[model samples]
Target: KTAVRVSCGEEHTAVLTKGGAVFTFGSGRYGQLGHNSSQDELRPRLVAELWGAKVTEIACGRFHTLVRTDSMKVYSFGRNDQQQLGRGEDSPPSVPLPVPLQQLCATSGLVIENIFAGGDSSFATCVHKKDLCRRLKNDETPPSVENMVDTWISGCDSKLLKKIKKEIHETFSSASCMNRSFLSQSKDKHFQTSPDYPGLDFSLAQSVFKKLLKKEVLSTEVQAAVVQLLPALDGNPVGVEGLRVFLVLNELLHVIQKLKKQPNTRLAEEVAAAVQKLSPENLQIIDSKVTDVYKRDFFHHLFLRIVSDKPEMFMFNDSETLVWFSSEASEENVVNFYLFGVLCGLALYNNSIVHMSFPLVLFKKLLDVEPTLEDMIEFSEAVGGSLKYILDYEDDDLEDQDFTFKIHWDGMDVDLDPQDPQKAVTSQNKKQFIDAYVNYAFNTSVEKVFQEFQRGFFQVCDQRLLKLFHPHELQGMLVGEAVYDWEVLRQ
Candidate 1:
């Protein structure tokens, strides 16, 4: 048989064949040979116990062997005095046996990708999948909020309840939960449970979340509970809870939006303040060491969900936080590029939703803040080069083409100085405040933002924004050269 993979212990060897079989040889002092007795194998011996399963990978310890199957099942044999094979029991098995880690992995919400072992210790790297897909694959019914509450109560201790209450109290009393430097951390430092509250399981926490999403519950109480419970999410040893966290955060967002209209102004503001803290910078923290495809895609889907489900939230609130990383600052942490990629991806994926909103301004600010052509190109590639198309276009030869521009000056004072030191308009600061106001007007003679770009008044933009344009709609920049010059004169 063709050997696909091979690993060796201190005095034994294990080989994975292309046909999904394992062959063992050499020392059997600790049952490492996988035979029925502690006898050395002079020749390659097929691991008969694993005859039905196809072994995809293999790892050998000092006196034990670990193998992973094509179906993600893991098995082990040999020395178990140190529990190196991960069987829990101290007895060594003379034949290859399944590791039985599926239950633990499932509870933690991770897909086992690979097995690792050495020096009497072993590990299994896990990946995170989209929560919705995982639930479907597992055939789990979406438990009702009442059911979830009962489940939480049944599984958790009094300490967890007290902790949850304490978190709520602290959150409402705190001025704000927004962390300005969230993107600057070199390690995974997002929401986490306090060390004192031990044995908090993902299932129990998820049930609490489902219960909070129900309309029958008091919004304030649920809001407080969510804020308090967020930290416990940090307890994810495997990345399975990545999807759970995403869902929790999204549900909490809806709660905040509803709370904004409630009568309790103090509680509403507290909830809003806490909501603001859940920016891409904070929530998108990923462990660099994790190489699991599911875990990575989990975050990717989370970003997409935020942009697609709540475009305005990302455009007005989370998009503004991109300024936390200058091109230089981004180099200090990979999360900068990762979050930016999400923003770019957001614009690309939800181009129609964000086109009339603040997305273009976000692109402009990112181009300006990005320190290098490489980073700029990376940002551009993230959005499929639509950004570059917007930045570089010729409108001079388009005089014959009909164009319109729309600028919202609804709240601006005509006399405000654009050049005043106290009112100085930084490029990003301008984009941050004005982009939302910069929108397409759906009228016969409506002005367009692109005309300003053609006239060398507004920055250049491409036809991507035109995706929002109607057949009768005008296509031009919102600000005109005359208006721009007038503003300069007024300043």
Candidate 2:
């Protein structure tokens, strides 16, 4: 509940937590407090609407507030007569709502990097994109935030949408270039031939599609326009058109996966049907390269959400599809890059122990596929050893909620001299990199997070399996004294 930072509006104040939670207090008139009410709060109160979100920063205008989440989403609530909220709505918002930076983000693929407010107007900024710099040139007017929503909703930019649709159509209509586009690197303009799948901008389509979705500009007309074109690529598994269709569907699945609510079943079915249309040969290609398709700016958001404890962000419920994917990936051969991503996520999100249900057999196979030593030891400690020692056969009713672990990181020993010209990567630099990596994985307390994952593992696994971990091994894991090989831990 500690506030890492606090901001004050004209009369209201908002606080952001070390844990990324948001709380607000003071006046709420004009909805500046972001709690969806105009009444003043005498003390700090949680903004329930943003419960699952991790807010990183907050900015307040004279009579409004703008908060940015770690996920790059910005929300505003308060006075907006000047349209400072950046929303399309005519009236002020009483609750925190997402601000549409869709147009700006579509061009830059950057988050709201900074925000500033004036007496009557609000300004937000995104990371400058090199491509935008090249495209805008020296003569264009400076960008303005006015009328964004109006322009978006009224389709004032319908030509752009049509252009995108046409590009999709033409790309997929050709039979020669389908699979190549999906795996092609971004192309230099001078060397590029086809504009649709221009030199390695595969992620451009992904970002554009996501930007369109975020803007609330996606229309039924647009969806139908894209989906209706799919039939033309039938039987031509490697056709250029089929690749285009898959790209759109893949981005849609990513978007739908991030929704906190029940998915749009109709859209899901449409996407599923499209996936089903891929012949077995084509399906193998997709299965092999699925991870590559997901490596855009949206990957972090999608990975963080899907690997969450409750894990409902994505539905891979098609058993037949799962079988296909699994067949292409194994200990001797790995097809999907996401399999390792999932394992890394499991290690990071503390789901490492759940793999114990397969009796460590599946976990062993994964280790062979990618012998990332650090990940394996972290996973082993998380799933196997640490929890049994801590819990020690407690009854179901025995709650040890008060137990906590205090962790500390010792600095590394580096003897290399930085002044030596021959030593580009000094020992100190290597140590720094290693420490930084470990800190990122474990956050502040490496020991505490490691123990917590172990606790979670114990909470999930059967009591009988506690015997699988030897006492000495459990002690070694808990004290951070173990050296586990990626090859040996699974055994």
User: Best-fitting candidate, measured by TM-score?
Assistant: 1
Q: For model 2, name the residue pairs that clash.
A: 36-94, 172-241, 178-240, 185-200, 186-199, 186-200, 187-199, 187-200
lDDT of each: 0.46, 0.49
Candidate 2 structure quality by residue, lDDT tens digits, 320-342: 11100121123322212233233
Count clashing residue pairs per candidate. Answer: 19, 8
Question: Model 2 segments beyond 4 Å from truth?
Answer: 128-491
**How many backbone clashes can be found in candidate 2?**
8
TM-score of each prediction: 0.30, 0.26
Measured by lDDT, the strongest candidate is 2
lDDT per residue for candidate 1 within 1-491, as digits (tens), equals 75668898899998887688999999998888788689999889998888888788899888988888877788888888877777757444786777888777888777777788877888888776475456558997544434545644443444466554454344422323212111112223232422221112323333444444443333455565545554443333344323233333433444443434443333333333332234343333322221232232333344444344333222122233221112112222333234334433433322222222222333333233212233333323432243243334354433233211222222222223334424433332433222222221111111222222122211122345644543212211321111236776788
Whole-model lDDT for model 2 versus the true structure? 0.49
